[model samples]
Each structure stands twice: as structure tokens, then as C-alpha cells.
Target: MPNATGGQPPITGQVLFYKDPQPLSAENHGGLGVRQIAEPFAFLRAAHAVPVTVTEFGVAAASYPIIFVGDERTPVAVMGVRQGQNLFVDQNGYVFEDYYIPAFVRRYPFVFAADESSDRLLLCVDRAAPMVSNQPDVPFFENGQPSKFTTDAIEFCKEFERQRRATTDFAKIVASMDLFEQKTVTFQPRDPQGREVGPVQKVADYWAISEERLNALPAEKYVELRNNGALGACYAHLVSLLNWSKVVNRAVRTPPPGQAVS
Candidate 1:
């Protein structure tokens, strides 16, 4: 998604899953069309993590560690242990055989952007996406009207925006509770002989909702969390931590450093 902070310069740096995003319009994109994504994760090959919405906690927890990023506490599904690496994606650009795919990834190339003036979201698409083409297998419009494919994309973007709003609210609650703590994950390295060598290595430093602090919350606050459906998401995040090692292990099995996985 475009930066939540309105009126910022076009999102600089890598825009996560999107390559080049532009608002969809009949005037500028009337000749465009999209093809079915045979490899759903092709765009995710370069991403180590993907933004996740609150409603995806359960399924996301099953496949990857769900954690918050930065001071905003943005929820994300961790796909790799290091920056710029995605262990789940194989050389063919497909995610692990049967892993749960986050909606954020599945909705690739199509996203919603807020029109600051109108205070409404407009559906956008990545013009550089491989699926996008003038000779597309599926047309985006027909006779100046949105085609079935475009209609479906619009509906999907709307649903994703609704989930995104709920995610923002959930993040606010987590932040307000003051439950997060900085944590460092470390692992021992192996020599060519595969023997553990040297001191432990730091994998990542990140924030997580402190379980100790959560357990110590006042009864009223705990009850409030339960009533608001955040309790399950919290535990799911905690449980997902176990998958961190799984990601590290996959990284270890990948082709040695400096070699591209894809």
C-alpha cells in the first residue's frame, strides 16, 4: 500500500511488493489487460517480508512468523531471516510447496491508494507487472466499461482496504498497551566441517509483545483485550515465534551467500 502518511513524496525506496504503481483509469489504462498469475509468488522473490492485515493472523501464523516492524508496529509475515532474502521462494519463483500465502502477496500488482482530496481510496495497479499487457489474456475493460476481471480486482482491493483499516486499529491497541519489547535473536555458526564455531551470531533485532508484561496486565485490561478479539491474535503472534528457527534453517540450506536463490 502507499504510505499511510498522506501527502508524502512518492514512496521512495522499495515499495514492498509493488514495482511501479499507478492509479487505474480508463483514460490512461484503457488498452491494458492482465494475465492469470501462474506463479503467484513471482513478485515476492525479492521481498523478505510482506505486510499482513489483522484478519490474516490465524493462517499467517501457520506458515510464517507474524511480527511487528518499526515504531508503528506494522504487522508482517516473515518469509526470510535476512534482509533482501526470501527463503520461501525457490529458483522457479514459487513459494514453498504448500505454505499459506498471505493476502498481501496474493493481491499483488493491485492495491488501494487514498485520494487525499476526496478522502477516498482509488484502486491502483503496477504497470510494470509481467501480467499487465496491452495484448492481455484478460482485458481490463470492454467497450469503455470495466470488464469482469477489472470488477473482480476492484472488489478485492475494497476488501483488502477494509481489512487494512482493522489492522491499523489493532496495531494502535497493541501500541497503547505498551507491551512491546526489543529482542535480539542469535544463532551459532558452523565451520566448513559443520562444527559449531565462534560466538553466537545476531540474526535480527526486533520488537515483540512481551509475554511477561501481558501476563502482568491488570484484570480489566486483560478482559478488554479478550472482549475485543485481540487476545487470540496476540497468542498467535507468540506461537508464530517458533517459526523463526524454521526460517533460519531454510536460509542455511539455501545456496551459500553471494549466490542468488532465484
Candidate 2:
């Protein structure tokens, strides 16, 4: 967007995604461990391009159910024994291990916005879409009321870790989920004057992988991509689909705050 002085003014409120580079591990500290995962954004920050949030992280399988509420009201349950010890949830709430929290975030869409005052930003699941019911079928969190999935997720890792102990072959402790087929909407940002810059192409390319690869993705990985505007591809394609030049010209000619044709 342009300023009154006619420059490519600092972009305010532009949403960007920074891909995490490593698996969530004990070394970095909960959530903090994966903060550096999005290295590209680091480069931007060095150049004074601060992101509102470092939106996503990666983790292993068996952690998705703990971070999300399935469309099915009835939760998926698992139990087993280790070192002559019986590990179980006692038919109440599901128990998750900390190692998997980062991965589960990948399955759903999330948003991060800059706080403006400090370097730290806000991170949370997109209220527009949230954890689905984990019963009969998995689906999106219902309208208006975005579930506390992300909020619960933040603390879930700590609790899981506190209760966790060293044990080999945690076969019983590990669990997997079958998420429902779903669709999403993409929104391209406009310049300050509200001129649509079109979809960010690079973002789209990063997400284009085979259905097989997608199917193999754990829920957390899936949620991270989906949550971080997975629609970037479709959104970018819309420029060609809807005539990119025409849209840009229309925005320029509209005589708005950011669109004064030169």
C-alpha cells in the first residue's frame, strides 16, 4: 500500500507464513523449541520485516487427537502396558504426549498477528474454522464459536510432559486419527488502498504435493498447512482464473485511499 508521499509504504497487517525447519524437540522448550523452525521469516526479520507471528510448527504422529477435538463426539481411545505398568485414560479424557503437539497444529488453520509494541506476537487457531467434533465424523468447529483448541493446545503439551515418563516401545501410548474430507476459503490481501495484489504464488507452490503424500501426513502436519492458509494456491490461481490484469486495473481505477493511478 502507498503512503500520502507515494511510496511502497510499509505493509501493515499483511499475513505471512514461516515454515518450521525442525521437529518439535525437548531442546527448544515447549512451543519455543519450534519457534526457529521458520527460518525464511528470520531473514525477513533481519531486514526489519517483522512477521505478526511465526504461525506453524512440525511434530510426529499420535499427537493430533490430543490437540484437536474430533468431529466425532466420542474420542478415539488406546491403552497398553509398559514395564509391567498399565497406562490408560480411564474412559474420561484422552491423554497425549508432548512430543506430538507441534504436529497436531499442522492439521488445522492458525493465525498470528503482530502486537505492534513488542517483538512477540499473538498465535491462535483461526476462529473462522476450528477443531471438529471427534465423534461419528470429523468436521470443522461450528459457526461463530471457534473452539478453544489452540488455547487448550498450549497447555496440553505441559500436562502431557508432566505425566510422561521414560518408556521404550510406547505402542499403547501412541494413537492415530482419520480426519474428514474438508474444504477451505482463501483471501488475498489488498494494498492499503484495498487493491488486491493477487495470491502469493510461492506460498501455493510449497503446498502442492501428491494426495498420497498428503494422506500420509500426520494430523498436526496437515493442520499446520491447512491452518496457515493452505488456499494460497487456489487464491493465486484465481488471478488467472479471474483475469489478473483486469482486477489490478479495476482496483487502481477505483480511486480509493491506496489506489491513485499515476
Give residue 56's lDDT in candidate 2 (0 to 100). 20
**Model 1 residue 234 lDDT?**
91
Q: Model 1: residues >4 Å from true position, as ranges?
A: 1-14, 36-40, 191-195, 256-262
lDDT scores of the candidates, listed in order: 0.80, 0.27
| Per-residue lDDT of candidate 1, residues 1-262 (tens digit) | 3321133223233557677877777777788888766765677877788888888988888888888888788889888877777888876778888788888887878877666566566677788898898988887778877788887888887888889888888889978898888887778889889899989988888888889999999999999999999988898889888888888888777864378756
Local error of candidate 2 at 155, Å?
4.4
Model 2, span 143-181: residue lDDT tens: 322224434443543333332221111111122222222
Which one is best on TM-score? 1
Alpha carbon lDDT of residue 47, candidate 1?
78
Backbone N/Cα/C clashes per model? 0, 29
Best by lDDT: 1
- What's model 2's overall lDDT? 0.27
Tell me the TM-score of each prediction against the true structure: 0.89, 0.18
Return the TM-score for candidate 1, rounded to 2 decimals: 0.89
